[model samples]
Target: MNHNLLLDSIAKHIHLDEEETALFLSFIQPKKVRKKQYLLLEGEVNRFGMFVTSGCLRSYNLDENGFQYIQQFAPEGWWMGDMYSLITQEPGHLYIDALFDSELLLISKTNLERLYKEVPKFNYYFRILAEKSLVSYQTRAMENLRLTAKERYEKFCLRYPTLVDCLSQKQVAAYIGVTPEFLSKMLHSEPELKP
Candidate 1:
């Protein structure tokens, strides 16, 4: 499997030697997922952290009324997983699925721990990743409570500029916490939101 992207990601935080890189790569397994395929479902324990090589994936939770509230979108070059379940090894509340046919490199929790031991620098890399993920989640939570729907839409656009043209209006609405009709209306009323 091609791992240039994954290696580049790792290189951003740590310098891995050839041996270290090979050992790290040996621990990960590559998998292909079809569009709309579920990588993880609610009530199932999440065992792997996935790095997207191509396409996109989304994680969402279902409310009591069965409405979906999207938590995140992992496009190419990003990492994603059910963090709570991966850490605690318990059933997760989120459902993770591919938005397009995708390739991923998956590292299981067991193997990840082994990686940390084998390549201690990975601990620092993962710590940085966890901190960034936590901050993003916290910021989104605050934005949901404090920002207007239009402002939230703007934030979504700013955050995922590459995604705007490719994603469906319904998916965009889900991320910005609005109904698809509401999003369409807002876009129509404010031409500036078209971007």
Candidate 2:
């Protein structure tokens, strides 16, 4: 399997020597997931952190009425996991699934801890990633509270430009926190807003 993408992502944050790179590679377990396949389900403890090598994955939760609310999308070159469950080893509330047939590199919690001790620099890399994730979540939360559905859709389009045309309208509606019909009306009313 091609590891170049993952290695390149790591290189951006930490310079790993040949031996170090090999060690890191040794910790990864490759996985392939078909579209709509569940990588994780509600109440399951997440044992691995996944790095998307190809295609897309999404994490979402369903409400009592069975409406889905998407939390995040991990496209190629992105990392994803239920941080709460991964760190605490407790059940997670979200469900994670492949949005398209995908390839991933998974590092189990045990291996991740070993890497932190063995390479130490990985601590810095993960800290940066966590900080950025936190910032993005905070920004999205604030926007949800303040922005209109149309504005949120615009932001979603900007954030996941690659997904705009590829995702189903229902999926887009879920992410933007609007009903499909509402999104449809908004798009039709504002022709320029169509992604």
Candidate 3:
């Protein structure tokens, strides 16, 4: 299961001795999703935080015009869920769905808070994680709105080389705020994208 990978990731910021580690590990359950399945829907409250072990998932918002804007994609070793829904127990603002069949290590919100209480360092870890996520997404948002197609494609490839190969052109284009055909042209013209 390579539990060490998960353990190491968390331990870097938060440490758990033998007893606390056991309790924390006990609540994390294995979850799986078939392709095209929903981890969460826009109107449902999210109760769990998912850590991807394999495959791909995306969060998107459907607009009044029925357009889907891909807000984020979490592949292996990434955390996912609707933060607003999880924290507030309100309806999720985005839909979280499986882009590929997936396996996840999950922790319920109840257990998550319990873990935080049992291990105060975990609270600090979460704070760090939240801040980093916000900053990274803010940078991505700025780039999408301000950069040229070639520049954005270059940045995307540089930043997410792993995910770039897994996603469809249409999906990547949506994330980058461009049409699929436009993304294709950029890919061909840009040496970084061309093999």
Candidate 4:
């Protein structure tokens, strides 16, 4: 695995000197997850915040009826975790799983705090991540309310072409808030839906 991918991603946001970078890397624990493996399950406390170095991971929830609703997809360079659980040290409702065999760099909450205190600049990087996450969730909520199924699919295709190709049609339909059957019809109806 390319451990430098995590370092490069951090460097993009903050200036880390050699010693600081080494210290940061020391705090990260590299993990490999198999496809379909659960990194976190509903009701489990999230011990670490994860950075995807390769392959895909997804955060989702299951309804009472056992239907899946995808909250987010984390491809390479993306981060995943339940912030509420990590912050409060409580069990989380979200389920996180590897959609494909994946490599990750994980930092525990304690280590993250130490990194903030030692490096300081990581605070800014995490802040930007949180802000972007907020914007993404807000946009998704708005799109669900305002956009048609086809429009949502179009926007999704534009935003996450990689995911559209990597994920199954049913998974894409769940993310876009449509039944797989309906999404199939919509896709067949439009040539542009082939993302």
For lDDT, the strongest prediction is 2
- Of 3 and 4, the candidate ahead on TM-score is 4
Cα error of candidate 4 at position 68, Å: 0.6
Q: Which parts of model 2 are misplaced by more than 4 Å?
A: none
lDDT of 3 by residue, 1-195 (tens): 546657877888876789888888898998889999998888999999988888889999888977778888999878998989999988888999999999888899999988888887888888998999999989988887899977877787788898888888888887777778888887777656754
Candidate ordering by lDDT (highest first): 2, 1, 4, 3
Residues 1-195, candidate 1: write the lDDT tens digits.
779999999999999998998899889999999999999999999999999999999999989988788988999999999999999999999999999999999999999989988889898999999999889889989999999999999988898899988999999888888999999999999998886
TM of each candidate vs. truth: 0.97, 0.98, 0.91, 0.95
Candidate 2 lDDT tens digits, 69-129: 9998899999999999999999999999999999999999999999999999999999998
Which residue pairs in model 1 clash with each other? none
Give the candidate order by descending TM-score.
2, 1, 4, 3
Tens-place lDDT per residue, model 4, 67-101, is 88998899999899988899999999999999999
User: For model 4, how many clashes?
Assistant: 0
Candidate 1 deviant stretches above 4 angstroms? none
Candidate 4: stretches off by over 4 Å = none
The local distance difference test score of each candidate is 0.93, 0.95, 0.85, 0.90
